[model samples]
Target: MRAFLLLLFVFLTLGAAPARAQQPTPTRVIEALYDQLSAYQLRRYQPDSGYQLLTLPSTFSGPELAALRLRERQLVRVDLVYSAYRFDPKFSQRQLNIDRLRNLDERLPGLLMDPSITWNLIEQTGCTTPDECQQYFHGFVLYIEKRYTKADTKAEIGRLTARLNATEKKIERIRAVRKSPGKPLACGYPHVEDKLRKLTKRIKKAYDCTQKDRRPRTVTFQAEVSRQGKVLNVRLPAVDSAGAAAPPCPEELTGAIAEGLAFTDGFLLGKQRLPFTVTGRLSLPLRPQQGFKVTGYYLADSLMRKYRVKLLRDGCQARQLRPGDATEEDPIPNPDPNVVTRVLERHPDWQKQTVVADVTGSMYPYTADLLIWLQLAAAGPEKTFVFFNDGDDLPDKQKRLGQTGGLYDARTNDYGRIRQRVIEAMGAGGGGDAPENDCEALLRAHQLAPEAQDIILVADNHTFPRDTKLLEGTRLPVKIILCGVTDHINPKYLALARRYGYSLHTLDTDLTNLSELPDNQITIIEGVRYQTTPGGFRRVSGRAE
Candidate 1:
């Protein structure tokens, strides 16, 4: 009887061993855990940000783990174990609740040391289906080293303060120029046709493009005018190789013309005689159109509609002129220039830039300016352009901070291809919200142009960037050319510049640094008062002290 009982016990124990063998081994379960964690990391990781991943062995001491956690930025960790739970109709939350509690522990079990060990107790699932479904527990240990440390951000703050001091000095120089008086010149005031004729004769010798193409074409030129009515600088559009194929006019001509040109009065915006840029044209084959026609090139058409502009007197009059004498182009017609134009005009030294623009509908005005600037500037392979819509028609809920993407970049200086990329990004998505994925676009721009000298971010003033957290991962010097700023600047941008050492630029003001100011110190910029605080900064209320 004893021999028969022993045989039955052995047979029953063998049957249970086969059932346990069907479950996944600890190694397979840990592998599955890493797969899930990797998906989460993929969403936020920036290229070249320097992150380390580690899968600690189960035998790792608790003290060692604590030391690692102290030295590195503990991005995230997952602690779980893999085991099958019995199918249950009523207790579906049972297995999930237990697994979560286990993950919350400071130290996870060393599953690698005992691959064959089991919890022994089976938990019930919350499954409600008529058919049976299998359920299992998951376990893993994932550590992601963070990129930015507290010390890194602190050092950037110091740099920002230094930059701000330098900017203040630059403002002083600008103010001195603005205070000067408009000089008297031989040119008559507002005699548009007569003055144009005289001016054209002065520049006829320097208008070299006409020598190459006898075709009647209007080449437009833009000049900056100080509030004191002094002509500060001049720029002519790059030769249209696709069209007239003329070479750029001589630099000597631009310098000579700038030296001679002066307005009777500085351009006025409201009560202030602010600096402005004016556009005029040098038409080839010096002859007036047979019918009445506009004198200035169509370059400033958008600028005219957006700002108050006066034509030097519309409608061209017929006049015969000699080859050595071109018609005097109408005197400068001031247009309130946008940010893109201002940055390109003021910073001629900013070359080989990777220009990243937000291409939502709100940015159309600046987008037009960007296209215009690109058309006028000399083309080079080093200049890269990137345009982004918030997401490629992505639904709002699915948009994650650093991952939301509707970004396209063109490395070549080909205007046609650049324009196509702009169209492609815009077509993919209409910027969904007022807050944009600006930092995300910037990060992608850096990835595309890793060796670029600097990043020129053309941004909107009203909206704040959505992924500012990722700014810490950026490597290049960011020059933010902000648009739509009128009465007040956005404080979020101020904080960004302060924390990351980015320079903030508008039409007239450049905030290179926002650190070292005493708390509650008020600084006026471009007529707007801003108060600095430990938290960041804000547009001051009421009048300045």
Candidate 2:
């Protein structure tokens, strides 16, 4: 069946589909490959020949005899390339492998040598298994090393020196410019309310009052702000330390002060996210002789937010922080639901169940509970999880807009990891109309994992799936566990259950031990579908299971 779909995809992509002149999308083309291939094979794609052909303009011919023949040949050449990629899947895979190495080399020039954590494998490899990706990455590293010699390193160093010289010259020129009584104002300082509060809080916890103070009691610094409010320089007053060891002020605390200042509106030249180095003074009131200049970099606002008090404290005794006070920014603002409690209300047999869930912020509470339950339940090792963002879909008169979320395999046996990595990333933020991409996600999940018999979907009950075609097809009986919503159940979900012989289950996380709750708006009795309009549940057209 998948083979057939791949062939049809090839035909359509080659501009060979009858009556459908429009070209196939990259997503659909990939989906076709997914339909026929194993997960390992998913990484492979035609780098040189296949992708080029797929991107070529469709064939066109006119009345001129010579020109018409030429056009036909051009079309055939391109179609043949497309055919090779589609028909012989191995060719495409080879292309993808070649492309991957080249891409890695181009993007991260010194990837193997540079042990920086900047290389994000998941984003780079597009969600491949960790082992497969690492294997490929290491191979590419070796390939790069074989050619990168001492001469190459020397040449790179020379280039860096030249760039540095040029930068220094530019800085001199900028500094040479005559200034007014005050530095040029970039603009009104942008509000740094959050950053300012955080900096103050960090400064207050310089020492653990409960424990004997080991380090500096006070640190003071002066900052030079750029036109755009970035911290260009930080300097401490020359301390009157009589040639002795300075008070040890933590670098982390001063660094936050610099960044918090940078985030504020300075001169406001042109807005930019940039780095600046600053030096500040350290002081200890108890030991006046211990004081010195400290130097550090001002971090980008976003990067600064991630600096944790716990980690920064390092070996220092932790100052007792206020219980309610937050040391870290709240995870994408939304109501926090205890997913574990909700999942416990009706403990699930996790074995043999493929979990499909909506992770949108609105659904986070319910989704969180589901994940907590998954963590607690000693489920089968076989279960696969799939997550998707609800994106735009079309219907008759009404249009669902702003829906653009991609599907990612967010499944893991380690439920602990899910809570930390996946759940923490979920925010009440997304695009697309009020409705989500549940239909598309389910369809994709179904295609990805055909073996899992029982499909359990954690869905938002507020909106229905616009793509009804997914329901029209042959499918497993789904258990649509409606979460975060109850009064309303999108009729389409019911339609899905009705069409595919699945059952509907709604959980009011607030209520205990509830099961299989019905929608308040629409009621189904026997085999009839009825919607509440001005009147109530008058039998609608479709059959209700």
Candidate 3:
């Protein structure tokens, strides 16, 4: 295998059936602006206290009108692209950029929003999905093109002509008094008509292409590059509805390139090889039946036996199971053959099982499996459930201050209602910022179901438990029913688990008998297989064997 293959992942087949690729729609830009930043335009440009980059600035006699119009459109284009792109998690340095925009400095990380720059910043970032970033950029520009119809263009041309006549009359009056036409005015206005004519032609061409090219055939990869320009490593990552994952870089396709596929500078940012991260897609002409082991990427990352060193965290407080860490009692045979069902079976004597879940947008997608979990594992009268949103649901929750605040809008009880709440929240669609109030929910669940012996915290791996302070007083050992966990386990979560004696349990959604699962429910980072342990993913049997 090439060293790049070591990085991880294989080709991702984004769609099925024969059709052109999807086109970008500009309206999404408007929608995102209102959704994230709470920004909405009341009407088209007019003189107002609010900022409007495209406000009709002045009547133009010649080229300046062309210059101003071009500048305004460029800024508008930047505004539209950035507004949409910011929503993507990979676009980091987000908080800093958002802070600036919310404060009214029309600048983005790359573009200053200055009229002087035409914004070549349209360059795309490399990623696991090939050409996705650049393709989106093309879609955005075309969206802008399609948004302005031919009627709208004609109207603008007529309006500019009117402005030109007025300006020309004023210039004639001024010139009559000036015998000494000292320095010739460096007005670029004379070029406006030609410039606009060319612009309209270009926009029409792009619009036509947008109509013709529904999708582009391409692939994207993400890698850590060294100063030497060598591929230090590459791996495809994914996100769990419960949290997030690195983007997918399909392996079967990647491995197809073998040891030495050199991506041109198109994949790299700038000419310099200084250590940095790069993610991009390249167009590839691949044929069907080209499949290899697309599942290995996940297998290697999530199921690999590599573990943390013996000692863990501040003052060596965390403990790893010694090699001989088996209980003296013969292992409790799992009643449910399903890999995930064995999680609750960890403590056989426990009569009642209590599940405390982070039932948010991410968890909602797994509703089918969730129903399976409830029906199969949590169905008995001995089982009780507690559900809540982030910290806001609990009164004692502390605020993170500058970072994300708890968005706990949910609070419910009973086994029956729990399912409905999770589905509703999932459909309603606000996962909130990264950190959830999982701590408070856990704390509350403990109080309500104090008698339940085995407490399972159904955690979304992306969000960390912020209520460690409450856990400080927790007497009962909590077994984490880790939901949506994939290839990479957050070391911090493991550290906390070590400190609290919480043994982690994840699902193997691929159980032959339980194949009703939708794609989102199986949260592994990449595709991998786990050994059939007596209880969950407790050990790794060489996957190859």
Per-residue lDDT tens digits for candidate 3, residues 1-545, read 23112211110121121111233212322222222221111112112121124421112223533444432231312231222233456655334333323332221222222211211112123323534433432211210111223344344434433543454455444445332222221111011122323433432332233243334344445555444444456554453233433223345433432223332222111222224344543332332223111111111222112211112122111112345432212232222233234454444564545666665544543333344445434344645555544433222223442223332232333544655554443333333333455666666666667776777666765455544545675666476666546543433454455455566655632111222223213222234322221111211211110
**Which residue pairs collide in model 1, if any?**
58-110, 80-139, 81-139, 92-125, 92-126, 196-328, 197-328, 200-328
**Best prediction by TM-score:** 1
Per-residue C-alpha lDDT of model 2 across residues 390-503, encoded as one tens digit per residue = 431222123232234445554566654554434323322232333456766676667777777677777765445544445555666466776533233334455456545666
Clash number for each model = 8, 23, 41
Instruction: Judge candidate 3 against the unseen true structure and give its global Cα lDDT, from 0 to 1.
Output: 0.36
Provide the global lDDT of candidate 2 against the true structure: 0.40
Looking at model 3, residue 493 earns an lDDT score of 52
Task: Give per-residue CA lDDT, model 1, range 497-535, as digits (tens).
Answer: 777778888888877767556666778767755666554
Instruction: Flag regions of model 2 displaced more than 4 Å.
Output: 1-352, 379-382, 391-405, 420-429, 488-490, 508-545
Order the candidate numbers by lDDT, best to worst.
Answer: 1, 2, 3
* TM-score of each predicted structure versus truth: 0.40, 0.30, 0.29
TM-score of 3: 0.29
Task: Report the candidate with higher lDDT, 1 versus 2.
Answer: 1
- Please give the ranking of all candidate structures by TM-score, highest first, separated by commas: 1, 2, 3
